[model samples]
Structure formats: structure tokens, C-alpha cells
Target: MKITFPHMGNAHIAIKALLAGLKLEVIPPPPITKRTMELGIKHSPEFACLPLKISVGSFIEALEQGADTVLMAGGWGPCRFGYYAQVERDILKDLGYSFRMVVLEAPDFKLSELLNQIKDLSQKVTTLEAVQATRFAWFKLNAVDRLEFCLAKMLPRVINKEEVLAIYRQALQEIDQVTTRPQVNQVTNKSTAEMEQLQQHDQPLLRLGLVGEIYTILEPACNYDIAEQLGRMNVEVYRSVYISDWVNDHLLGGLVKPSNRREILTSSRPYLNYFVGGHGRETVGNAVKLARQHYDGIIQIGPLTCMPEIVAQSVLGEVGEKEGIPVMTMYFDEHAGATGIQTRLEAFVDMLQRRKKSNQVWEQGEQLNAHVPGC
Candidate 1:
């Protein structure tokens, strides 16, 4: 079967590696762009979340390019994501696209069932081959995450941003060209070293934490590349979630759950004690954690009308007031503009810098007063 899947950040890279290794013909949808957003907006319900629309648009494009089968990750939560696959299937059918849809549910809940699904997808490959392919894909997934984490750390400090970005783009291309885990490791290591060599200031201009729905945070196009924009403004950005961490927690049941996740849930308890939907709990929790860590500001981005983030946004005002950190929430749809996002970011960064300077001055004055003799 000629299969395709939606794009989420660098997920398609690992997915393509896995499916191709299984000896399946893979048809990757084109990179997300305005055209993809337009297609999704035209076909999706006005109130549907942005991710659903973008994914539907991706499938339509893939089908037109001869992909007959689609593989989608299923969910089980209060989040609308749980209903996406079936809804998209119906929508595609109505649009007269002929394709088969395979929805892979949470592997942590039913490991054997998830294995059977993988087995079905890899009918042509032996068990050993499938295992090797899966391992390679997992390696690529972690490697990409590490590379991205490095970028986030280095972006705000680099002397010439374009130099770092060029190397990053090259590293991605090199990783995509390799077929083995060792090659992936070599490329990632080389990229990391190259980034380390870029001239950078001893300290970042500012530090910000990004908390939001997974798709919007990971998909640069969906958020108008907010992280990069912040980086250009010399703000070091830390994301609350990563695809590898999500896979480890939700799919692999790896030995150690991410500490940040546990901390986030705990910190969010005062405001939101239960799962509202989406990443709302995580959003609230991460904001609390970042505030305690003394991050200058926090930004939450999500699709417009997303229930979970909406819930998180409501609680964030109180969190910001209690924690004494600035929090900004941004919602995106097909209509979001980069210029507007940049302007908002610029204003927010200015406010943060002034606040940081004032705090530094106040601390200095307190220290001086403590050392002075009584008069």
C-alpha cells in the first residue's frame, strides 16, 4: 500500500524511516504551508481545532499525489483529538477521496494491540526486521529532539543567527539522508558540536518558557515559528513538551517518566486538579513550574477554540497573579499573521527586560542598605 501521514514538526522524518524500512511504499505529504492551511479551512468545520484542519488538508494533498492509505495516531482523553481520525475519515469520504485510514491508539494502554497494528502495517517484513526498523525510528526520534533542544538553547545566544540556522537545516538534511542508527548518531553529534562552536554571549538576553497544545508548539508553521521569533529577539526559549518525551510516556512506558511532567501536574493542582482536556493541565502546571524557576515570562499557544488550552488560559491569569510572572496566550487559525505575532512578542520582550532590570536594581539597593551603618 502507498501510505501517508500528517506532519508534526520532524515526526514525518522518523515515520518515513520506519515505514520505508518495513518495505512499504510511503508517500509523504508536502511540507505544511499556506496552501495546506487553505485546503483544511475550506473543508473543515468552522469550529474544528486547527490541527484537525491542517491534517485533513495534508491527507487531501497526499491522496491527490497517489497515496491511498493514511496512518493516524489515535487518542483517549477529554481532548477532541480522540475523535479526529473518524471525523477526518467521514470528511474525506464526503470529499470523494478514496483511501484507507488506520488509527493507531495509545500503545501504553494495550501493548499487544499496538504491536498487532504494527504487524499489520509491516506484513511484508519479518518480525526481526520490523523490530530493527522500529528501533531505528525511535533513535531518529530522540536524535531529532536532542537537536531541537540544542537549537533552543543556542538560538538566543548566537552572534549570527543565520549561521546557526544554516547548520541546523543542513543537519536535518543529513539526518534524512542516512539509513542507520549510527549515521543518525554521527549527524546529531556533528550538529551539536557545530552549534556549540557558534559565537555566543555568556548569558541570554532573556529566558522564556513555552507551554501549549502539542501540535501548535511543535509545528512551526502552525505557530508562525514563535520560538525562532523569540530567539531572534534574543530570548532563550524552553518548551514544556517534546515528542520523544511524549512517546516515552504515552507509548513506550519507558523506565522513567519525564520529571517535568510530574512536576507540572503537581504545580497545577491548586488551580486545576483534573484533566480538562488536551494539554491544559500540563499548560497550567508548566507555567507554575517556570514561574517558580524565575523565568522572565511564559507564552501559551494553541489552536483557536481548543477546549483544553482555553481551560488552561482561564486558570493562567490566577497563576500569573500568584506567581508574579508575565503570561501571554496566543491562538492560531488559518488567519494568523506572522507580523502581528512578532509585534506582540516585541512588546512582551520589552516589558520583561524592563521588569528584570528593575528587579536587579531593587536587589542591589536592598543589599547596599543591609551593609550601611545606622545614622
Candidate 2:
């Protein structure tokens, strides 16, 4: 079977490796572009979230390239994401596309069924081979995440931001091409060293935390590359979502320790005590935690009409007021424009910088007062 899946940032790399390892012909969808966005908007319902539309377009592009199966992840929550796979399947069927829709739902205590489905997908492969493939794919996922973490740290500090991006892109390509863990490690280390070697300004940098819907948080195309944009503006960003962290919570909950979820809940207890579905609680929690840690500001980005993020955005006002941290929420859809988003981001960054300068001046004035004797 020729299997394909929607693009979600670096997820395509590990997913492609996993399917190829399972002895299936993998047909990765083309990189998301304006055409992809147009296709999704044209076919999807008017009210559907941006992710669903983009995913439909991605699947169509892959299917047109001879892929026979579409692999999609399923969710269970009040969030509309849980229904996306079924919705997309219907849309594709109506368009007269012939393909198998494979939905990998959250295990939800039915792990045996999940394994059985995976086994069925690769009947020719043995259990040991599947285990090895899965292990390798996990390593690849972590490797890229490490690279991203490094890139986030270096992007704001490096003198030549474009050079840092080029190194990061090259490193990702090398990681994708390698098959072994050692090779992945070697490339990650080399690229990280190269980034570190680049000349950097010694000025203090603004730290911003990004919290929002998983797809928009992880997919640059959906969020107008907010992380990169902030980085180029000399802001150090701490993102709330990572694919490995999501897998740890949903797919491998039994096997992996849910430390991340526990931390999120603990921090979110004051503002939101329960899951509002999607990453709503996590967004609130991460924002609070980042505020306590003295992050300069926080930005929440998600698709328009996303109920969970909307809930979190409402709560964030109180969080910002109580914690003394500035908060901004950005919602996007098919009609969202890059220029407008960038202008907003630029304004936010400038405000943070001005606030920092004002704070410094106040501190200096306070020090001067301390030196005077009862003026």
C-alpha cells in the first residue's frame, strides 16, 4: 500500500521513516504552499478549522500522486479535532477520490485494537521489525526536536539569522536521510556546533512563550511561522507543543511517564482546573508558568472558531493581569494575511522592548535615589 499523511511541520520526517520501515510505499504530501491552502479552502466546509482544510488539501495532493491510503490521527475531546478525520473522509469521498482512510485513534484503553490495526497494515513485517522501526522513528522524532530547540536558542543570538536557518534546514535534511541513531546524533551535534560558532550580539534578548492549538503551534504554515518571525525579531521563543510530547501523552501513555501533563495541570489549577479539550488547559498552564519564570511576554495562536483556544484566550486576560505579563492572542483562517500577522508581531515585540527599557531606567533612577541622603 502507498500510504500518505498531512504535513505538520517536522512530523513528516519521522512518519515517512516509520511507514517506509513497515515495508509500505510511503507517498509524502508536497510541502504546504499557497496552492495547498487554496485547494483546502475550496473543498472544505466554510466553518471548518484551518488545520482540517489544509489537511484535506494535503491528502488530495498525495492521492493525486498515486497514494492509495491516507493515514490520519484521531482525537477524543470537546475540541472539533476529534471529528476531523471522519469529516475529511467524507469530503474526499464526495470529491470522487478513491483511497483508504486509516484513522489511528487515541488508544483510550483499547491499545490491543490499535496494535492489531498497525499489524494489519504491515502483514508482511514481523513483530521484531516493527519494534525496531518504531524505536528508530522515536529516535528520529527526538533528534529533530533537539535540533529545533537548538535553533530556537540560536536564532535570536546569531548575527546572521538566515545562515542559522540554512544550517538548521541542512541539519534536518541530514537527519532525514540517515537510518541509524549514531548518524542522527553526529549530524545534530555538528549542526549545533556550527550554530554556536556563529558570531552573536551580546545584548539581552526578550523571551516569549508560544501557547495555542497543537496544529497551529506546530505547523509554521498555519501560524505564519510565528516562532521564526519572533526569532528574527531577536526574541527567544519557548513553544508549548512538540510531537514527541503529544505522543507521550496520547499514544504511549502507558509506556511513557506523563510528567509533562502533570506539570501542565499543576500550573493550570489556579486558572483552569479541567481539560477544556485540545491544548486549552496546557496553553493557560504554560503561559502561567512562563510568566512566573519571567518571560517577557506570551503569544497564543490558533485557528479561528477553535473553541478550546477561545476559552483559553478568555482566561488569559486574568492570567496576564494577575501575573503582570503581557498576553496576545492571534486567530487565523483561510483569509488570514501574512503582512497583517507580521505587523502585529512586530508591534508586540517593540512594546516588549520598550517596556524592558523603561524598567531599566526606573531601576537606575531608584539606584540614584538610594545614593542621596534625605534630599
Give the top-scoring candidate (lDDT): 2
Q: How big is the positional error of residue 235 in model 2, measured in Å on the Cα after superposition?
A: 0.5
Cα lDDT, all candidates:
0.88, 0.90
Query: Please, what is the TM-score per model?
Result: 0.96, 0.96
Candidate 1 TM-score, true structure as reference: 0.96
Instruction: Give candidate 2 misplaced runs (Cα > 4 Å).
Output: 110-114, 371-375
Evaluated at residue 132, the lDDT of candidate 2 is 73
lDDT of 2 by residue, 268-288 (tens): 878999889999998999999
Question: Residue 96 of candidate 2: its Cα lDDT?
Answer: 94
| For every candidate, C-alpha RMSD to the true structure in Å | 1.6, 1.5
Candidate 2 versus the native: TM-score?
Answer: 0.96
**Clashes (N, CA, C under 3 Å) per candidate:** 0, 0
What's the lDDT of the predicted structure labeled candidate 2?
A: 0.90
Which segments of model 1 are wrong by more than 4 Å? 108-110, 202-204, 253-260
For model 1, residues 221-317, the per-residue Cα lDDT tens digits are 7888999999988999999988877766655554334445776799898899998978999999999999999999999999999999999999999
